[model samples]
Structures are given as C-alpha cells and as structure tokens.
Target: MNTPLPDVANSELSQALLPLDWVGMQGIDIPLILDEPGVDASVHARADLYVNLPMPQIKGIHMSRLYTLLDRFAEHQAVSPASLVALLELMVDSHADCHSSQSRLRLAFELLCKRPALVTEGLSGWKSYPVVIEAQWCEGRLSLDATVDVTYSSTCPCSAALSRQLLEQAFIAHFGAGPVDSNHVANWIRQNGSHATPHSQRSVARVRVHIDQDAEHLGLLNLIDLIEGALGTPVQTAVKRADEQAFARLNGENLMYVEDAARKVQQALATRFHASDVSVTHLESLHPHDAAASSSRRGTLPFQAFDKALRA
Candidate 1:
C-alpha cells in the first residue's frame, strides 16, 4: 500500500498565531504578451506575485497554486488591466483554503519601439523603454498603475548663459578694434562655435499613471509621445549628419534643468492622467552627482497616496 505524502503546511501552527500580511514569491521570470499599439506583442518580464494571509491558524499558504495559476493565465491571454483583474480574482479563489483576502502583482519589463530619425525619413531604429505594471485586488475592487522611463537630453540654462558670455568675450577679444571683416567673423565663428558649448547630459523621466480600470488600452505610446514632445529633446537612434545637426539645434533651443523637466512632464501628462506622478533625474556632466526633481498631480497622486498606503 502506498502511503499518502505528508502535508506539513496544514499542521497546527506552533509558532505565532498572528496573521501575516503578504506571503509569496518575487523575481519570477515570466513571459508577457502585450497588445499595446506601436509595440510588439511578446515580451519577457520579471514578476512579484503575492496574496494576503488572513488566517492565523494556517501554517502556510499554497505557493504552488499561485505560480500555476499565474502561468496558466499568462499563457492564454494578453496582459492588461481587465486580464490582471481576472488573474488576481483567480489567485484569491485558489487561496480560499488559506482564507486569503487579496492579491497583488508587480511586473517589470522593457518595451521596444521603432523610431525614425529627426531629419532622415528612411533612417529609423529601435528604442527600449523600461516599464513596470502594478495591480491589486482588494475589497472587490481592482486598481492598476503603469510606469515608464523616458530618456532625453537636458542642457543647463546656467551653463548655457555662461557659455554665451564666454563666446561673446571671445568674439570681442578676437576683434578688439572696429571694422572687423564680415567674412572673417563668419569663418571664425564656424571654426570656434563649440569653444563654449553648453554643458548637456542625458536624463531620464519616470512617469506613473493611475489607470482607469475600465479602460481597454494602457495608452503608453501616447503617454511617451506627450512627455517626449513636451521635453523636446528625446534621445535619438539611427542618426545621420543632418539628423545629428537637427538634434543639436533642438538641444540648443530646449534648455532645461531637472526641475524644468519634471514640471514639463507633469503638466503634459496632466492633460490625460489626472492622478499621476512624475520624477526626473539629470546626470550632470559638470557635477559628480546626479540632479533630480519630482512633481505630482494638482492635488495628490491617487495610487501612491491612498491605495498604496492602504496596501502597506
């Protein structure tokens, strides 16, 4: 006769009887199929899946159930708010024996998109965007949020002013006396235009939007375009000489600091997402440390302020 395997998790709890908050796994490798526009449908993501432990007497929750449920759900449907709601519901149902009340999930992945050069019509390349999707099912309500990282160029206004002053001083010193030849001045400027170019550096903008649960689409591409357009200096790919020159002109025109970038993205995104958050960090070429700034919606961010706090 074959003896049934032992189930130690069902044994009476000898340890503390207090209920635990969250019990599950983190950094589980998973494949995600997204249906977002302008982006490919397949991606690899890292996920943190969890469910609340509401029963004090239970030794441990069913860990394998969570993994298998997630695997089955991901293998069938595309990742989205509605699908996530269904998945969390399944997770909670599967943990009913342990008296679980809620479920939460965090998925991190990179979104790839093809972008065209600034000036060259035929030249284009792919860009990778790091993103995170968080969802929670509690009290019969589903809440979701999407966060994206956008890269751009930032030129210090102070540094640009200083550079201009130096260039002006150089021009005056080059022609101390009057009656400077126009051709000589033009040639001189062409030769030394970059003698005092403003200090510029690549920067990243992290923006999170509290998604409407009923919405079908995430609108990530639109969000990216809005922020990138507002900043006016999104990093480029597949650049030719003309494209590079156009990018240079754009940088010269759109001078900003970390605070400026944060506010710009905040305002631009506000038109679409009322409950959102924005933060930007400029890796300064002149300083040893990075400069960063943050901004939020008009009143308060809905997700991090209320829903996230309650979850904590």
Candidate 2:
C-alpha cells in the first residue's frame, strides 16, 4: 500500500486572521505567444502571479497550482487582453480553497524587432524593446495594461543653439569680414564643421497605456511606431557612412528637451489610447545629472505599480 502525501496547507490555519491584498509568486519564467504583427516567435517572460487571500482561516494558497495553470495556459493561448483576463480568472478559480476572488499577473519580456537602417537600403538589424503587461481580475471586472520602453537619441535644443553661436563666432574670426569665395567657404565649412558639436545623449521613454479588456490584439508595434515617429530620432543599428550622415541630419533637425519628448509621446499616444502615462529621460552628456519629465492623464498609471513595472 502507498502512503498519501501530507496536506499541510489544507490542514493548517493562518496564525493572524487578517485578509491580504495579494499573495502569490514572483518572477516565474514562462513562454508566451503574442498575436501581434511583426512578432513570429514566442517571447520569454518573467511572470508575477497573485491572488487575493480573502479567508483568514486558510494557511496558504496552492502555489504549485498557480504555476501549472499558467504553464498550461501559456502553452496553448496567445497573450492578449482577453487572454490575460481569462488567465487571471483561472488563477482565482484554481485557488478557490483560499477564497480568492481577485487575481493579478505581470509578464515582462523584451520584444525583438528588426529595424531598417535610417538611409541604407537592404541594411537592417534587430532591436529589443522592454515590455511589460499587467492584468487584473476582480469578481467579474477586468483591467489590463501594456508598457513599453523606447530608446532614442536626444540632441539638446539649448546645446544646438550654443553650438551654432560658437560656429558663427569661429567663422567671423576666421574670415574677418573679407570677401570670400563660395567654393573656398564651402570647403572651409566642410573642414571646420566640428568647431562645435551639440551635446547629444541616448535617451529613453517609458510609456504605459490602458488596454480595453475586450480588445482582441495588443497593438504593441503600432504604439512603438507612433513613439518613434514622434521622437524622430530612434537609435540606429548597422550603419554606413550615408546612414550616419542621415542620422546626424535627423538629430540636428529634431533637437528636443525632456519636456518636448514627453509631449511628443503624449500627443502620439493620444491618437490611439484613451488614457496614457509617459515618462522621458535624457542622459545629459553635458551635465552630471539626467534630465527627466513626465506627462500624465488623470493619474491613469498608479505610482506603485509603475515603479514595480519599471524595475521589472
């Protein structure tokens, strides 16, 4: 005869009879397929699964059950707002013994996208975007959100103006108001263009948008395109001389401050998402500190949650 395994969780009771808001596992590795354009493979995600512990009498929930349920669901389903809500419901149902009425889940992954060179035809490379999806289910109501991190090049407007002034002074000092040949001036400019260079730094923008619970597909690529378009200076990969020149031109044309970048992203997101939260940071090449700005729409993103998501 075989001996039955001990059931400590079912038998034991909580020492303190108080309900907890959330209880479960964090950073569980899993595979998820996304039903979105430009994504052909499954992405690896670090997931945080939780269910509200309503019963003070219960010692703990079935943690193993949560893992297995997520594993099974991920193996078969593509991640989307409806799919996430369904998974949250399944999580709560699986922990019925713990009297769980609400569930929350977070999936963090890097989305790899192939990007073409700025000006080089037939030259493209892959760029990885940090992404996180948070979902919640309470009774019958559902909430879903998606956050993406975009990296770009930011040339400071102030720095550009100062650089121009310095170049102007250099030109006046060199020429001394004498009549100059056009060809000679052109060659001189080509040789001495670096008299001053505007300060530029690689910057990042983190944006969060509320996803409709009933939506079928996550518009991640479209959202990224909007942000890149607004910024106009997304960091490049695999470049030729022409591509580098084109990139420099774009940087010169799209000079911005952190506030300008934040507003650009806000305007881009407004065209699609009803509510958005945007945060932009410019790692200043001039100053020891980074410049940052935030744009919010009615506090759509909770501070605690946004902080945690960013860390992930």
**Per-residue CA lDDT of candidate 2, range 184-302, in tens?**
88998999989999999999999998887777788888889999999999999899999999999999999999999999999888888877889999998999999999887744533
Clashing pairs in 1: none
Off by over 4 Å in 1: 177-181, 298-302, 305-312
lDDT of each: 0.87, 0.88
Q: Give, for candidate 2, the lowest lDDT window spanning 10 residues.
A: 298-307
Q: Encode model 1's per-residue lDDT on 1-312: one tens digit a residue.
A: 599888899866848888888899989899989868778778899989999998888999888999998899779989877889999999899998988989999888998899999999899999999988889899888878888889999999999999999998999898886988989999999998778989999999888888888888777788889989999999998999999999999999999989889888888887887688887899989999999898767433337553342242
Question: Roughly what TM-score does model 2 have, to 2 decimal places?
Answer: 0.95
How many backbone clashes can be found in candidate 1? 0
Which run of 10 residues does model 1 get worst, by summed lDDT?
301-310
Show where candidate 2 strays beyond 4 Å: 299-305
